[model samples]
Structures are given as structure tokens and as C-alpha cells.
Target chain A: MMTLELYNYWVVIFLMMAGFYMLIASNHLIRKIIGLNIFQTSVFMLYISLGKVAGGTAPIAAEGIDTYSNPLPHVLILTAIVVGISTTSLALALVIRIKESYDTVNEDEILEIDRIADEEGSSA
Target chain B: MINEHLPALQVVVPLLAAPICFMIFNNRLSWLFATLVSWLSFAMAILLVMEVRDGTVLHYEFGGWAPPWGIEYKVDILNSYVLLIVTAIAAAVFPYSWKSIQKEIPKSHHRIYLTAMLLCLAGLLGMTITGDAFNLFVLLEISSLSSYTLISLGRDRRALTASFQYLIMGTIGATFILIGIGLLYALTGTLNMADLASRIPALEGSRTLQAAFAFLILGFGLKLAMFPLHLWLPNAYAYAPSAVSAFIGATATKVAIYALLRFLYTIFGSSFSFDYMQVQWLLMPLAIASILFASMVAIFQDGIKRLLAYSSVAQIGYILLGISLVNVTGLTASLLHMFNHALMKGGLFLALGAIAYRVGSTQVKSIAGIGQAMPYTMAAFVVGALSLIGVPLTVGFISKWYLILATLEKGYWPLTVLIIISSLMAVVYTWRIIETAYFQERPAGAAPVTEAPMSLLIPTWIVIFANLYFGINSSLSTDLASRAAIILSGGSLL
Candidate 1:
């Protein structure tokens, strides 16, 4: 009943959790970035869906238009979208550098490598 | 003509100059330009503080469209103090980086470092100055992104992983904040924080506001590295370039704390957050845990930067502890510690950077007999350590005095004992480094290190001197902190 009544919110929550789960569960750094993207996208959708007004058209002045979906949330989402894209790109760039240095992108492998490095650094 | 636009220019000048700084391409020129820009912003922050000294709020409407319609840049005593901290750190760190980054970062990346520094400064100032909620998010990301870049500039490969982890955590935190702001907007149909402040009172017991408040605090908790969410911080601060460690150690988290204060006090109102929501109950426990937990961890850290990084978490706990007390004195202590932390942490990290410059490493073992090697830098480190321990006639002592006073006023005797115990923990951690550097003999075959260059020493001392000066003569800091605290508590400063 809840899902059917508030389907859009359910969709957002579901996507958010899945993305969050993947972000924590993934071993690959790139996958983590992908998960982060999915997570961000869900938030964007939440804003966009909530801005919609029933029976409303685009928020532009017209002779017949009495109601219009709020344009402000859409504007806000646009900015958020830009932020998301930049985060993704920057994260991927970090992963690339990480892969170059550590010779692997698997989280455990990189961590192991760093551990080894720390051990060697201390012992030397 | 310029007075009205000062608030906007406070952020705009550095933001616009960041790209141009990168274009300069020459190393020293880039450093000089960035330093000049930081000083300019610092001066503007000082000016803003002076203007708001009488407790008047300066509102700058973007394009003259007014609040609720266009973006607004608002300056009050609370945020002006934050702006001063952010810009003052940037001013000092930029000059210090002139020499430090040359040694720590590659020549090719020098321009990028300066550019990122300016961008981060602009972002922190913008987040503090803006009256709009969404604008704060945008600016927060701007600062967060640049800081990630800054952290990754360290010569060590571990810096890459540290920066990567920070980016992931920071992005998640920011997205949570965005979702919270969207919820607030959905509830109130506006994004202006001042407007939201007015409308929020009418929506009492609204579950949506409750949800918004929950998301906002959780996100800010992560951003401010409140206790358990602090995993990303120590490594991020530890592996970053020395100048970066100093710059971020001083200002980044302090600004985040300021943002939290704004949301907790101004937008939500202390009554709503404290009385109705009982947020202090939640915050107080976390603050206590961070102090004891992080201080304990600091004692075990082998790396000096990592030690201080853990201590930063403990210091953050002190600020939050003050906040959780829910009175003007507690709030005053929080603001005072924010300023004092900037001075001490900035100086300590700069001193550590100097040690790293000479010793080529900052491991506790690596710095054996370092006091004799680099007398001035070690002396500066000792002073910073003393301040960190809340020794008498230090900034840390003054803030802790106020915090203890605040707790006592609330009949929290146990909390006083806990504060003293935590300060003892600080003593233990700092004593480890001092004993290693001064008391121990230099291992055989070790090269004799000279004192850090005058350039590094001077900037380091600037903050060190400020830390000592502000500690002895606390009138200025106390006045600003109390006035800011009063405003935050919904009281008229006048």
C-alpha cells in the first residue's frame, strides 16, 4: 500500500539503498565510483519528481496555463547534476592514479599493498 | 560604493582569481598572486567583522532581486569569524607553501597547487558567507573538491588512496546534505536560509522537517568528522602535502563546524534543535566519545601528522562538547576553540611541515634528537603542543576554561572530570613526541639537520605568535566569540 501510494519516493529510496550498498560492497574502486553516481542520481530524481505538479505543464507563461510544475527544483537538480558529474570524473581520475601507483584497483589489493609499504617503511 | 558589495567580493575575488592563478604558469608569481589574493580576502573578512561588530547583519542581494527571489550573501558576526579563520589560514599557508610545496610537490604541479589552494579558500568563504542553502552546498563541494585535489598532491602514493577515500565519503556526505536541503525546500517552498528560518517555526512537528534535520546532521557529522565518521580524516590529513595538512587542518573542518552551528542555531533555532529535538543528547555522547576515543588513538599514532590528525578529531569533540551544552558560555567556548584551534593546529602542522622538510620524514622514531637539529622549529612545536594540552596562558587553556565553566554552570561535574582526563591524554600524546625529539640521542649515521629556512619559520611563528598573543590577551577573541554566541542563541547582541 505504501509503495503504491508513494511510488516515486519508493523508487528513490530503493535506488538510493542499492547504490549505497554497491558503494560499500564493491571491491573495485571504479565500481565504487559508479555506485556513488547511482546514489547521486537517485537524489536528483527525488528532487525532480517532487517538483512535478499534477496536471501542470512547463513553468512558462501561457494563455491557458493555470498550474505549472515548479521550475526551481529542476534548476536545483541541474546544479546538483553538474556536481555529480564533476565528482564522478574526479573520482575516476583518482582511481586511475591509484591503479597506476598500486598496480590494482581492487580495494583489498590496494590496502594490502599499502600495508606492505607501511611495514617496509617501519622496519627499514 | 564598495561597502555594500564586500560580502560578495569576499568569495568572488579568490574564486575568479583561481583560474587566472593557474594561467600565470610561473612558480613564484603564482605563489605571490595567490598569497596576495588570500591577504585581500583576509582583509575583507576583517572588514566584514568590523562592520558586524555592532551585531548588524549585512545582506547582499544577488542582482538586487532580494531574498527568496535571488541568491543572497549574508554576513553576521558568527560567519564573519569563520571567514576570518578560513582566510587567515589561507593567507599564512599560501606564503608557507611557497617554499614547502616546492619541496613536497612536483614543479609541474606547482601552479595547480596554488590554484587549488585559492579555490578551496574561496569555497570555504563562500559557504560561510552565503545566506542561501543550495549555494552553501555548491560552495561546499567547490571547497571539498579542491581539498581532495590538494590532498592527492602529496608525493606518497598513499596520498592517492587517502584522497580517493575522502572524495567518496565527502561526496556521500554532500549528497545527503543536498537531499536534506531538497526536503527543506519541498516543505517550505523556498531555499533562502533566512526565509527558511522564518517558515520553519510554523511547521512544528512536521515529520518532513524532522527527516530534514536528521539528514542534515548526519551529513554534517560525516563532514565534520564527528567521532566514528572520522575514519576518512586522519589518513587524509596525514598523507596530504605538508602545507595542505596545515591549510586544511586549520580551516576546512572549522568551516564545516561553522556550517553545522549555522544550521543548528540560526536556521532551526536552538529551541527547536535543543528543546524539541533533544539533539544535544545525541551530540553530547558523540562529542564525549570523540574526545576520549580519538585522544587514545592519537597516543598510538607513529606518524606526527597522523598524531595531530587524531588530535584534531579530539579537538573537534571539544567544540561539539561546547555546542551540546546549550548555553551562551558553551557556545562561546565553541567559537573560541574554533579560532584557537585554527591558530594552534595551523602552527603545529606548519612546524611539522618544517620538520618534514629537514628530516625528510615525520615518524616519531625518525625525529629522534630533532630538537638539537632544528631548534626554532622544535621550539615552535613545543609551544603548539603546550597549547594543545591546554597549558595556562595558552589559547587552549582559555577555551577549556570557558568550556569547564559552561559545564559547571549546568551541574555537570562528571563532564569536568572527563575534560581534565582528556587533557591528560593530550599531555601523554604530546609528551611522546617531545621526549623523542629532545631527550633521545640521535641514532648513529644520521645527518645533522639545520633549522628550517627563515621563510618557513616566519609563517610558522606568525600563527604561533597569534596563538600566544590571543591566549594572553583574550579580550578581542572573547568579545567576538560571546557576541557571535549570543546571536546564535537568539539573543540580541546589543
Candidate 2:
């Protein structure tokens, strides 16, 4: 049942977990963005792998290609990649602003700053 | 000619208008243009609703490509109603936003704010109308990204952190939805919702389908701010500009509920989702917890917006509770509440925005006795608060009444009691506002405040009147909700 042929999926699982762990475990905002990118990449890989067919050529109208890999997932993944890029850029821009405002990007430190502000605002 | 393309025009009008607002580069002009476009969208939505009133479905193909091959725009009783909710809320928010944003946002960022607002409106509308899974994912991102920009535009530096937190959470949620759509596509090789629905019955026992269902529910639950996953909503609403809190607070999560309904009833069918999967068992406890826990938490929040945000989480629980009932009355209650809550919360936020304009903050204590200073706005807020608490003759009572009936129909006395308890909690939180604003006197020597501008007051009252109007009539919304719920729970609309 442990098929070595599904190694691509195994790789996807590994990368998805690694990146997701980084997203949750990391303190630095920039590192969290990187982790998000990695997590997105795993999904991209998942879609790409789902399109493969044994002995299939590229989805092009060539001379003799009876079997061709599915191209729809690739097209969908392209859109996903664009969305992923926008998210990363927006996230990075927010982090830069956050850094300038709080002067730190560490999650705990930022929370501490906000918490102190909250305490003072309430007490005032 | 236009009527033939109502579904297409419904989304395209606002989608194209976003960039035009950006091009205008003048806040006043852009605001005028965006408001007009939102009205146009709302008009089209009303027309679409009329056409679909007799239980007919309207389909528009993208670039002439038929469904199961290309993206499609589909309209029916359910989505047309949802389209009205989003577009109508936008229509109300846009004019109110013109004045509110002037005070809450910087002059230079005004055009950018207008652009983001239009884009977010378009995105929400598009998400409501699209029948393709991938297209919905794309539109969801479009809305999420614009909302992040909108949230970030607030004057407070904390807006940056709030928007960032929401970005992280929203992105994760969208990705989870994408993963779900990918799995569905892998299983069925079709992105069209109707085609997938027709194909799904044969694949009910597949693990991939189950995983897709789980991912979709989890993803949507996060987006809709269902209880424990709602950590991102409070600060995001609290720190965002007043207009943004009003606009997004009204429309965003409601659209998420529409999406979840589509997946549950239309695509997967209720029997598979409820009977086989038993989603009710998992959903019930969480919904109950949200109703009890979020309401309890709302009683303690200092910021009025934050408190309302928590109440939103609990209101969402009520919606989920209705869905979990899997009965027509239950779903009717859910849909009715979605529309009613939009009016109540949207009006409350706009009134809060007016207060913020006059007083500079929305904290409960900061509003002390200013009720006399801003009688009109405070009155509107009081009506909205009453609606939020389900007082009779307001829209809140209409939906909550149906919810109680739904539970009673199911013979679930405990749930009925729980809902009543939560409504009482709503009274507690809202009473604090009433007492503080009406009973306590404004601190001596505070700047003498005037009423909100006519521009702001008109829209707030417009929404507040709708609450009373809809609550009193109840026929239009109740009729539509009953039919839509029947369609969903029946899984027979297609």
C-alpha cells in the first residue's frame, strides 16, 4: 500500500507541513510571509502533479500526441500563483509599515506593544 | 438588450468602475462616481431579483463559452437575494462613506480608499454571482485584498497591525478554500457548480470529496468569523475606518454565508452533507459555544465597535444554528437573519461612524451623555441597538422569532432557551450603551458637538428605517427567505 510512485504527493505533504509549521511557529513577520509562500507553493505543486499522465506529452496540437497531460489545473494554478504573489507583496508592505510603527516585527514584541497601549488606553 | 445580460452586467459594472475611480484621482469625484456605480449595481440586482422571483434560474456564459467548460454567471432566488444584500449595503455605505472617510482617512489616501472600496464591492458582488468554483476563489481574494487595503487606511497606526493580522488569517482561509476547490476539480474534472453537483452523487463515498467538504467548511467558517476562528475580526473592525467597518461589517461575512450555503445545499446536497457526514453534530456545539461565549465576551469590551464585532460572531452562530437544523424553517430563519443582521449592524456601524466623526472615538465610556448632543445619531443607534437585541417591531426580532420557532419545531427546548439567554445578553451589552449615552452627562468643557452632517444622517436613518420597515412588513423578506430556504434544503433549484 505504501507506493513509492506517489512520491510527489509525499513531497507535497512534507513541504506543506514544513511551511505551515513555520507560519505558526515563527515569530518574525517576514519569516511568516516566507512560510506562507512555501505553503502556497506546496498547493501549486499539488495541482501540477494532479495534471500529469503517464507517457503524456505537453498539451499541444503536435504531430502525434494521443495522450496529453491535463492543462486545466495548470491554468488554475497560474491564477492561484498570481493571488499568492499579491498576498505576499501586500503582507510584506504591511510588515514594513508595522516595523516603522512599532519598530519591531517579532510577534510577541508587537503584541506586547499593543497590549501596553491597550492597558494605557483603558486606564486613561 | 441590458435585461438579457443582467447577471453579467451586475458584476461587470462595479468591476470596471473600480479602476475608473482610481483614474479619477479626486476623492469627491471618485466618491460620486463610485456611489453612482453602486446604485447601478443595486438597480441591476433588483432587476435580477424580479426576473428570478418566479423560481426561474438565469445563466450567463463567459465570452459565449458554455458551462462545464468556461466560467459562468448564474442567478436564482438565493444569489439574487444575496446580490441585493451586498449591493444594497454598498449603496448605503457609499454615500455615508463620503463624509465619514473625510474625517477618518487622510486626504491623499482618499482616492485610494475609493478605489479599494469599489474593488471590494465588485469582488463581493462577483463572489455572489459567479457559478464557477475557481472564479469564486479568485473573487474572494479580490475582495479580501481590497478589504486589507481598506482596513489599513485608517488613521490609527494600529490599523496596520489589524489589517496585517486579518491578511494572514484571510489569506490562510482563501488558500484553504482553493485547496478545497482543487480537490473537487480533481474528483470531478469540472469547475462549473451545476456540473459538479450533477456528478457528485456518484462520488459521495470518496474520501477526497469528504476532505474537500471539510476544507470548504473550515475555510468558510474562518471567513465568516464563526466563534473560535474569529480572532481576527474584533481589532480589524475596531481599528478600521468607520466607513470600512460599516461596509465590510455589513456585507463580507454575509457573502461567506452565501458561499457556504451554495456548497452545502446546491453542490453537495443536504442529505450527503447532513445525513451521511453528520455536519450538524460537529456544527451544533460550536454554534452553541459561539452564541454563549462571544456574547459573554461582548459584555466586557470597552470599544463599542469591538463589542459589536463580538456580537457579530455570536450572530453568525445563530445563522449556523439555523443551517444545522437542516429544515426549511431553520434555513429560512438563517437567510432572514443574514439580511436583517446586515441592516442592523450596518446601521449601527454608520451611527457609530457619525459618533466617531463628532467625538473622535467609539469607546463606550467616551460616548457618555453625548446622546443629548447628537440626538438624531443616538436615536438611530438606539433603534439599531434594539434591532440587535431582537426587540419587537425591529428586524432583529423578526429573524430571532423565526429562529425560536425553528428550534421549537425541532423540539429542541434547550437550544431555544440558549438563544433566549443570548438575546438577554445582547440586551445587557446594548443597555450599557444606552445608559452611558443617555444617563451619564458628557464631561464638562468637552467641545460642544453638533449633529452629524445631513449626508451621514440620511444614510444612517435610511438603514434604520429599513430595519423598522422590514420588521413591520416582514412579508417581502420572509417570503423570499422561505422560498430560498426551500430551494436550498430541497436541493431542487437546479
Candidate 3:
């Protein structure tokens, strides 16, 4: 039982690490947003998994129910999901603007442009 | 009836006004409405502070649900004091934004700008006042989202990248906080902070609880721009619109620091956080490194706003250093520095806004001879700079004095010396700007510049004068801060 419970957390940790690695490693702005979505979704899943109980039904008032899964984490994650969506949309909007202005969505290329601009700015 | 709802109204007023601001498409009307809402919130904050000054904790339950079940708005001296600073800075910044935004932001984006500003204010106030752990995460996101919008509204193209960087980091921080809160809820079976605090003590040895604490610190450390995790701040500040630079510089991280304090001292309890976890050992070195490292970085920055942004990181170090001391005086210094730094940095940024208003640039070299052209604005900057350096008879000195005393009380003389050395580094950076502005001749063929409009000057000077006034007569701040600190440290000021 302990090994199984530990395995559940291990999956959560694996998803978390994978998501974070993508977020940090990706240079493409759109990919970074995707990475952020995955990162946040993994956290949401973690919360939901924590609420799971063996041999439990949905949390609801009923005439006969011996065990019920906790609904609080579900409720919390629902709100977090909304926040996550909003953040992703806003991030995409920023990427759109960044692409328009810098004419590139690659973080490295954008940094190079900014660096050149900075050099010219100081020299001027 | 209204008095009973002050806690809710403090956040609700700005939250509601944000959508209303969006509806008012006319730039002037939208700005007027935003300013009025900010002032109203500021007034409410003052009343709340006065009510809680005697160590009263105002607990307002939402939807008539008792705490540990229903969400609660908890306003004590600690939060009320922070609320006052946040709203006061908003109140001052909004009035100044009318003119500053006119120049920095496009006319078409003005309404959206005002709306985002109001939303950010509401979200910050909500974050500070909420007692539920989950509610704090929601409010944190609200403010974080709006601030990203505000930062991206800057005229420079780099603002886009800056805003995106901040969004990524802020969302990660918020997620970490959410995970921590979720873990705590699983442990305690309650979302309310007071409930958690009561239950946390019994589960002290649990690894999950310990992990939650670590996550909370790491998350809030990112949010507060603590040391090595502060990569997103300087660009965000330097590229953001001038008014935004002032407003967020003055309030956002300050609120994050308040959140850290609330979690560490109030929820986790000082004993668990400091004694069991040894958070001081973890935080102290980071704090010292930030103070030394960020200040050195500031000394080389060409852009004045970027310089001040790095300075803010160093100042945050001082606040955190106070916390790591884990004593009454240290905590008091931290609390006091939060208020004082708001005044000093707010005034400095607003002064920079005025210069940017006239010269259309914030580069140190570009502002040569601004002392002659924009005397009032430059004077304000000089006074703020002095305070930043922690000179005597300024608000900065009071905080540093308490900090040094706190270190002495702990027999940490070397730490005290480090604090003084950081102040000297501040002086060096500040002098670079002063020398460029006052001594260097205005570049040949440069257009003649005038003093910033009275609208900007008045707010800027009000903040600067407050710095001086509070420095000399610090009883009000010290009294409230000491009492709050005592509460946090589980001691009595008396």
C-alpha cells in the first residue's frame, strides 16, 4: 500500500519536472506558453490526486454512502484551472505583441536584437 | 452597517471599479474615476489602520460562514498597516498617472491601462486582507495577471518580453504557492489560515508539512524578487511605463513580503519556521548576498530606472535580513522598512517619471543638467536618493538604525557592518545620477526642458516630504510597527 501511494506521488513529481524542464528549456515563445500550461495542469492534477480516497464515491449528500472523495481540492483546482487559462491566454497575447515588434518569437533572437539596440543606444 | 463591511469594501471597491473604468472610454473620465477609487480605498485603509492600531483583529466572515469553513477577511495591525501603504501609494500614483500616462502610453490604451491598474490594486488589497490560504492564491493571480498587462502596456517593444518573462515566473510562483496550500489543506483539513495555524502545531514532524513550508518560502521568495530568483524584476521595472514602475515598485513586492511574514510567523508559527526548520540559516546568507550583489549591479547600470530596480532588490534584502534575525527589533525593522522603502522608492520613481516626462528618457547620461531644468523633480530625487542611502533624518535611517540595533542585540556586528557597506554602495549609484544631472552641461543643441507639471510635482513632493516627516517623527510608524512585530514574534511591545 505504501509503495503504491509513493508511486502516485512519483508520477506527480515526474510530470512536474518534465513541465518545468520544458518551460526553462524552450526558446520559442509559444512553446514556453505550452510548457507553462503543462506545468500548471500537473499541479492541478496533483491537487486532485491528493483528494482521491480508495473505495470512495463522489462527495455528495446521499441516503447511503460509506465513503466520499474530498471535494475541496476539486473546487480549488477548478478555480486554479480558470487562473491557468487566463494566464496562458495573456501570455499568448504578449507573445503576439513580441513577435510583431521584434519580428521573432525566439527568445535568443529577441535577446540578440535587444543587445544590439543596447549597444547602439550607449554608443549614441 | 458600512463600518461592518470595511474589510470587504477595502478590496471590493477597487475590484468593482476596474470594470467600470473599462466602460469609461474617454481617457480623462477613466483616469478621474481610477483616481477617485484609489483615494476612496486609501481613505478606507486609513480608517482600517486606525481601528486596528490598538492591536484589534477585525474578522469578517463571507456569506455568514464561520471560519474553518467560510472564507474570512482578517485585518489586524500587520495587514492593515500594509493595506495603508499599498492604497496610499496607489492614491498618489493614480493622480500622477494622468500626466505620465498621457506621454508614455497611447491614448487608445488609456482606458485599458486604468482598468488594469485598478484590478492590480484590488488584487493586491485582496491578497493582503484574505485569511483563507486558497483565497490568497486566487488574489495573487489576479494581481499578477493585471500587472503583466500593465507592464506590457509600456511603449518600448522590450516591454513585451519583460511582461512575458514576469508572467512565466509569476505563474510558477503562484503555482508553487497553490501546491503548498493544497498540501497544508490535506494535512489540516482546513483552508482558513487561523485554522491551519491551530492544526499545524500538532503535525509538526510531518515531511509533507515541512515540504509545504519549503515550497511556500521558495514561491514567495520568487514573488518577492528574493536574491538569485530576481532575474525578471530589473527589465520589468525598466521597461514598464513610468507610473507602473512607481506603483508596482512601491507596493507589489512589499505585499509579497507581507505574505511571507504572514505565512512564516502567523500560520507556521515562528517556532516551527525558525527553530524547527532553521529558516534563518537558509534566509540569512541569501539576504546578505542580495544586499551585496544587487547593489554592486546597480552601481554599473546606465539606465536610472534599472539602477533603482536593482536598488529595490538590495532593499528587499534588508527587509529579509530583519526577518532572518528572528527577534522583535529585527522584525520591527523589517516592518518599518516596508513602509519607509515604499515612500523612498515611490518618490524616486515618480521623480524619474517627471524627468522622463520632460526629456523622454531615463538613461543617466540623457538626464544631464536636469537639475537646472527640472529643479523640483530633481530635488525630490536627491532627497529620495539620500533616504535610499540611509542618511540620518530620513525614513531610511530609521529602518537601518533599528536593523543595526537588532544585529547588535544579536551580537552580529559583522552583519551590521555589511548593512552599512550596502548603504555606501547605494550612495555611489545615487551619486552617479546626481553628478550627471547637476554638474554635466546639457548636451549641445538639446531642447530646453521645463519643470514637470504641478500635477506630477505635487504627488512626488508629497511622498518625498512624507519620507522626511516620518524620518524625524517616527513615533507613529515605530509604534504600529513595533506592536505588529511583537505580535509576530509572539512577544509584547510593552
> How many steric overlaps are in each model, in order?
0, 0, 0
Select the stronger candidate by lDDT from 1 and 2. Answer: 1
Each prediction's interface RMSD? 0.6, 0.7, 0.6
DockQ of 1: 0.89
lDDT tens readout by residue for model 1, B1-494 = 99889999999999999999999968888889999999999899899999998888899999989889999998888888898888888888888998898789999999999899999988999999999999999999999999999999998999999999999999999999998999999999999999999999999799999999999998999999998899999999999999999999999899899999999988998879999999999999999999999999999999999999999999999999999999999999999999999999999999999999999998999899988889999999999999999998889999999999999999999999999999999999999999999999999999888999999999999999888999999999999999999888988855
Cα lDDT tens digits for candidate 3, A76-95: 89999999989989998988
lDDT of 2 by residue, B407-491 (tens): 9999999999999999999999999999999999888887778888999999999999999999999998998898899888775
Give me the overall lDDT of model 3: 0.94
Question: Model 2, stretches more than 4 Å misplaced?
Answer: B491-494
Alpha-carbon shift of residue B93 in model 1 (angstroms): 0.6
Candidate 3 stretches greater than 4 Å from native: A5-7
Among these predicted structures, which one has the highest DockQ?
Answer: 3
* lDDT, model 2: 0.92
Superposed on the true interface residues, model 1 gives a C-alpha RMSD in angstroms of: 0.6
Q: After superposition, how far is residue B385 of candidate 2 from its true place, in Å?
A: 0.6
On the 0 to 100 scale, the lDDT of residue B196 in model 3 is 92
- Candidate 3 per-residue lDDT over residues B419-481, each given as its tens digit: 989999999999999999999999999999999999999999999999999999999999889
